[model samples]
Target: MPTGKLEWGRILGRLSPYTIQKGFRYLKHFGFKEFWIRLHERFEPEEIPYGPWYEEYRPDPEELEKQRKRKWKNPPKISIAVPAYQTPEKFLRQMMDSVLEQTYENWELCIVNASPKDASMEYILREYSRKDERIRWKKLEENKGIAENTNEALAMTTGDYVGLLDHDDLLAPNALYEVASALEREPDTEVIYTDEDKVRGEELEHFQPHLKPDFSPDLLRSNNYICHFFVVKKSILEKTGGFRRDYDGAQDYDFIFRCTEKAEKICHIPEILYHWRTHESSTADNPESKLYAFEAGKRAIEDNLKRSGLTGTVTQTKDYGFYRVKYPVIGTPLVSIIIPNKDAREDLEKCITSILGRSIYSNYEILIVENNSTSQEIFDYYRQLSENPKIRLLRWKKEFNYSAINNYAASKAKGEYLLFLNNDTEVITSDWIEEMLGFCQREDTGVVGAKLYYGNNTIQHAGTVIGIGGIAGHMFVDMPRERSGYMHKASIIQDLSAVTAACMMMKRQVFEAVQGFEETLSVAFNDVDLCLRVRELGYLVVYDPYVELYHYESKSRGAEDNKEKIRRFQTEIEFMRCRWEKLLKEGDPYYNKNLSLAKWNYSLRPKD
Candidate 1:
């Protein structure tokens, strides 16, 4: 691993001129918040301060031993396949040892030697095979690529499930044990994957963890987040015909996409079961070392899209591994922009003006849900705004129930799509409406949310993460706006459990299907409640970072610091718990259980 000083220097050296330019823009627009966060991030990128949950998930040897003895009703034998091509002696031994040390004894380690000339690898494989009956070894006649080599290993496996293992990687001692446990619970699970982290340098310090979500098809299209600790039913693997040679660099990704399409049930084990070794040649250490991998990844996504009958153009982003799928608007449907405001005329005007001035989408209307604004200035501004044919003012005489207000406004909306936008948010992206509409109009998508920044250009809500702050909270909150978050999640377009109502767009049919937002959640967590309810109906809630906005967060409603507001907030929290207790306790499907629930960003749960 690089030393602290050396790592800091490298980080500085990689800082692009574009980042510096964005920094200056943020300083001018948002003031000191962006500057302060940038400085703090530069110094302490990995040292994120987390709450009690950080200490709660420490690995326990006693627990592992207990799990080892636990009886399973139906524990399927797992066949782990490793395609070796001149693998290092140390790494090769470690890989073999990790499988041999599995707590679940019903597993076979299938090692296929692609490099027949590598005497050291052959000797080690033969020695290990002789020592353990479960260890299977096969020497190839000639050296094929990773795809063909792995396929050869797959043919030798007889287990119910076939697992993929890297030649230079290490699995947690209890990795196969966890896989068996999950299968015992859900026997029909066709595909299973786990979170992973990188083993850096000679010291093998664990870092750069990829705490992945459950089965997310959209997220899979963005990038192969399920790159390691991957297991699939042998039947499913056969149906997919293993990996393709054309996508050799991204063979796993292509194979996974194909398998998932035919999979009946997909399961995710939220544990760091795999440690990806980051050597100089490894993609984890330097992505640029194999640019062909990214090109293959892009092709994988594009092929998946074509197979799924979705019309989209897949292209690589500046972030090497990440991709952007641009789905064209299906039709020119009228999108109603629903703004619920009380008194902030200036904020409301700014939001409306930005939409009118910057938006390229032609078919849209603005609905101002007037919730008892007392100011004469606000009334005057409303009267002037109502002059436009596209704008209309609706009155809500009752109390400030966010759900009730939006529900009332949605009922009166004439557009095919309803966009529940906050009055305090200003549009940053010129094609923000078009970008959101494309996703919302999709048959599978439920709700679409935009990336929001604070007045200081720090992230306010990249997306909503369930179980954060004990209920749900905005993801990547307070991070510098320009930075791509963990695994480029903050910048990529993907499926999430929930998204903030601050700038949410959805089709009229979807809104009606979920019956709009829950009125019981009057103030706090109403958006989350609505999103959860929407997800319950089997539709995906997406968070698109391409649609950018500046949200002077809650500038109209003010803070929840006062006594009455705090009481109401607490009541709403209880209401959400009472309503969606299963989702909260079991974990968000769009988030991993191993991640810290206390922090908004994807921080690792610290060991005690």
Candidate 2:
């Protein structure tokens, strides 16, 4: 939301030798067409300053005064717990001062000091306690550990809600006010968390603001996205039993999982209310400093999986802090790979060959639906493929109606799980089917999508986003597979609003529950509609980057070049807009509002 001229000089300065290196690599590997497209997508949007944007939307003095004076009908008191160690005088003062400056007055700060050696902190806390009665302090003779220290602070709180605050970090003036507002909006909410950013130095120069999506369970398992500005109900905290010493390095991550699982209604406030201060010794400044914390995070995810009545081996991904869970395929359930094909015998052959030859998971049947293929060679290939017991050939006499053809094939499928695939796609990962099946087998997962690339090394579809290109578009389109998306989103597995049906998997019961894809959306948006409807039925659509495939996009059906095809595409777009009017207007919950919908990349929205 920056409102000013583009600083071209500063923007060009960011194009370092690394940028040039990537450009040359792209040109050498992907050719000029792809190189130009990738370059445009990366640099077309101006890189705006988040500091100015924050300052522009930040609440003024008069607004804060109004919040301070507002009377509430039984406002729930929020108790903040701070566990302190060897805290510097400046940081300790700032942390306490940030709480004291809160607009909401019905709050208390419970400080459990383990910094016995730092005598200066004792004097600071005593002075603050004298100045404000809400500031309560307790000095522990010995540092019991972070988990126990937080528990000691939690024991001191008497409010209805409890919040955790790191001693060196800071809370924005509106942090407590937002929590109170969310409680009024959703009274049954047992857990509430806000987005946060990293700040440094005396002025607290803001950067790396995390504009998070709605509460996503699958995404949380991938990484601890909800690490800051967190608050929970007093009852929920009591039920979770605070934190455990075993997960001391990553106790907050473990505690968050426990709280969310116990809460009936969890709310997310999309505001940067916490500033995680980074200094020399802080893990935020250097990830390599505490490798043990990452291992503990992996354990926390494993424990959550066990609690959910599932088992998986959680392993670290290429990204340092991020992790991946390889859930074992339970009981070898049959998977139906349904492909709707026309002519393109070569394309269909490649698709089936990859599944039969490269696939590591057996016990899958391929149902190939032939939709009016005129070529004699395709029929010849089909006749040869019919000999295999694992492959079944079905006929569709009607014109290319994508939804109806798939629905008919799905009705005939005998498997418990259904996989919708495009004939133009060839499997790249050996265990691609198993990779997707692992996540799809989860009770909460309704749809699972694989990471797809174009014929070249560039990406075709990582996931789908609503209201991107009028209705919906794929994320990370044309980006090289070697590079990651914004904030390494391309490299991580997370929950999304929608995924391309060209390579999607879901339960057979779920497909029937939604009555299959909407027949009205014959070609375009049919997959997105099905995914959205599945989500409405309280299910998550996960995009796993580990499942890889090469998508020769539209090779069988060809492009929408003719007049009739273009008209049909336009009609589908209008249909999606009318059907999903609310989502388009309100924005996608899986995507952040601050990000630009103008492009597939998660770039900053230009505030003109």
Candidate 3:
């Protein structure tokens, strides 16, 4: 084992100690399991522990099989609401047919036809209702928009919970079965949502991950990240006052934010229970969605932020562009930049040079923790740069502990903000400092990160996707530069559950508030743990693409072999399970639920 000399600087003051203490504890509880799961997978091998708790907790195979074959004693009654307005009969009929063909026998189809003049839609819906007693169809006297139509259907729902089916979307064959089972598993779960996939022209296009808890208002502020095929408790819907008609373009997002805020518990089933249809008219298919939906989303967030008593700037763009926020800073905020490195002097130099040269804002310092360096040339280069007053050196003379080194460096930082930068990354955008600074200046922003691209000009990380099943994977991995998929919606910098730590910024108050980083993580998931803690503070975590950086990832450091990889991965599992157990049990809002190791176990490892 390697031991690094600890450099403890002036301790953080006890000012607002009450808020800080409570905030820290809240994050610890909220994030422990998520951090544990990620780190456990990263550091501990699967050979060390074969079966997961689910296997142990699950019924015997024979018993499960017997139960599966058994008839429903008390089947759940679900009201599937489809608010079809001006949608073609083919699309409307497909949606109706999917619902009518549900394996679950107890369900009702409530289609509030808002179609301008389509009597054919009514005829098709009526034909289905006549065939199945459960199918119910109604036409509004006037053309109420999506929000109003959804509210109309919601008003007619008498089931325990309601499931919203889009006019064009399709449900998986077993979607209702899964939702019913999840509801049975946790009766207290008032809100239940599952993962979904994207379909275009009747062909499956791509899969989207399911998110956990899905309640954290800050996470909702970033985007309507959660796909809403929710089986929400009718009472919770009523309590939250159902859907607001004002948010026409993005009513589901507004209603979800309001409902989750009031709901007692949220349960996320990690399965692709729904298929989101994407055509030219669909928002997911249109790049300009950010223009219309995002603008409406910004208004929704501003409304929520005001209600939550948080004041921050909101930037919007008509085209695919960078969005920002500049919260007023009352005084100087200390920011600590932690870089964990090995022996790559050139990469380190480039990272530092870009920051020193491009960063417009000052009042920050860098802590470089050289980990088990075998290259004396790198050491000499450090000496050569020693004349730069802002850089400080800390050596981890033993085995590399990525988390431990950052924790050590953070103790030495005097700034009010903490930034974790990869040594192999270089700043590409000059306002990167202000881009991040503007976010942290707000009291509500807990973590801020930049978009990272590889040297080949491909994305390294746009955002982290929780529950890729092993060691939390990132979305849009290795995707080309022309693609503006999620980032398009994420363009307007706002609240997210977590942001990548590669080039992250957070308030110093938040850093100490979370008690720095957890050292047990050693190599992986330290940043994720930090981000989760930031969310616990009831603040927003943002990924600002405007603050761009080029990351030459894993070049200096060699890849961990199979055994080492498992060690890191196992630790990640344990950390996430322990810290964010609620999220794991519920699901992470930002992570795609469509992926499962149970489905594609062999492809779990990154493709070479």
Candidate 4:
């Protein structure tokens, strides 16, 4: 079997045929420039260089020493728990040493050894315990499973906050310090987690960093994205009853889910504070060794849904650890798909035909708002479309104002839900409306966005992250449709700050609550502004990958190549900055602070 670099080559070899077909299709729709971009992305190196990021991440030795020496006023004591079972002496020492080297002194390392007969492991534990009173060791008479062992370690904790660490993993030198800092900043923070990376081979080369967003419940349900360096208030952990025996392999996932459910505030530190060891025996290196873990994770998600009073079914995807959640539709509310079009008859026809022919949902109306189309063919097409009882034609005699056209059409919409769809977009998912409706109907959700692919099957918009291009930009743009994004986020249902209005669904109530779109800002950033306002109303903006579509993005409007268009775009950018200055400065809650704001893909941000 191929391994390492050869593995990707082998995989690519198998995908070449399908890739070629997809490439040709893209060329047919998007032309040569898009095809070339997709081709380049297909073979681009997946491993992102972390050298500059590490330089930015690493703290000064003198500053760290000062932090170690300084006294904190009434600092909360944190207990670090490690469950050991036949652990190697080398790995065991490294794990214990990481805790010992912490800059924050108000911490206790609790080790519960399940391997009773391992003399070397026991000796190392005894030596560490003898050196510092903070290091506590408990040797079990018999070998218990991971969950039971972890519970034993938890039982030893007397601190206000409790943290879980894998036996083979290594914590960063300043992990506890950062956790303490965040706690100092947010006293109400009940659940705290930090970003982590995987250390592979004997040299302990760190790579595959999982830079996570700030407390995303939907993202957590999709997978255990918040895996390592997890800390929680001891009271909350006690309420959750620690770990479950049934979910031994995924006990941490289950525990974290329960903790989050009851947490007042969940905080995420963007720095890498944990190093997950990726040896052959480690699950990080070979997930096939622990197939039961994924199954347990699915069960955990299902239980969470049940507890939250949500009607949903969770299923595992082809991607090893990722999951798919199908939220049950609450009611068969009429959905009015409001599409604004000027010309582009072929694009409009294709979009309408896809919806009428492929959609499984029965109750929906198509409202195509014609904005000054002079062509007779467009008029003839409109006449034919009017023949269909499900289609409605709304006329907007004014100049092309995307926001205004949508607002006018929305006023005429009679459905409970409003679907803002681009004329250039075609449906790829049969139950797209059903999927979107599921999220929109939820009490907490305001806007529901679908995963849009470029005509060639490359991602157009997975979700929108604020601060990209100094305002807002699409996430995972130009990525292949087949891949499971940074952390399988592109393949799962997750909460985002915003999703494009190009193909978005929202309740009619939410649209009115946020006063529809801002017409003053003519073209760009209108959808982003709308979503942000909806979020300000304390509702989640969801991005569902299952509701897939092909967005031949902006085919009707064309490019902003002219001076007037460029000036108008700049004006809109300024408006957004003025309106959402604080949010832009603080960054998107659905995106990590450590991630690059300049790039659409979740690249590491360089330090100033």
CA-lDDT, candidates in order: 0.86, 0.88, 0.67, 0.87
Tell me how far the alpha carbon of residue 322 in candidate 1 is from the true structure, in angstroms, after superposition: 0.9
Q: Per-residue lDDT for 218 in model 1?
A: 82
Model 3 residue 432 distance off true place after TM-score fit, in angstroms: 3.0
Q: Which portions of model 1 miss their true places by more than 4 Å?
A: 1-45, 48-68, 561-563, 606-608
In candidate 4 the C-alpha lDDT for residue 148 amounts to 91
Query: After superposition, which runs of candidate 2 have C-alpha atoms over 4 Å from their true positions?
Result: 1-46
Tens digit per residue, CA lDDT, model 1, 272-323 = 7898998657887656667899999999999998888898888887655789
Instruction: Name the candidate, 2 or 3, with the larger lDDT value.
Output: 2
Separately for all candidates shown, the number of backbone clashes (residues 3 or more apart, or on different chains) is 0, 0, 69, 0
Q: Which one wins on lDDT?
A: 2
Model 4 RMSD in Å is 5.9
Candidate 4 lDDT by residue in tens digits, 361-456: 989999999999989999999999989999999999999998999999999999999999999999999999999999888888999999999988
Ranking by TM-score: 4, 2, 1, 3
Give model 2 RMSD, 1 decimal: 5.1
The most accurate candidate by TM-score is 4
Q: CA lDDT of 58 in candidate 2? A: 75
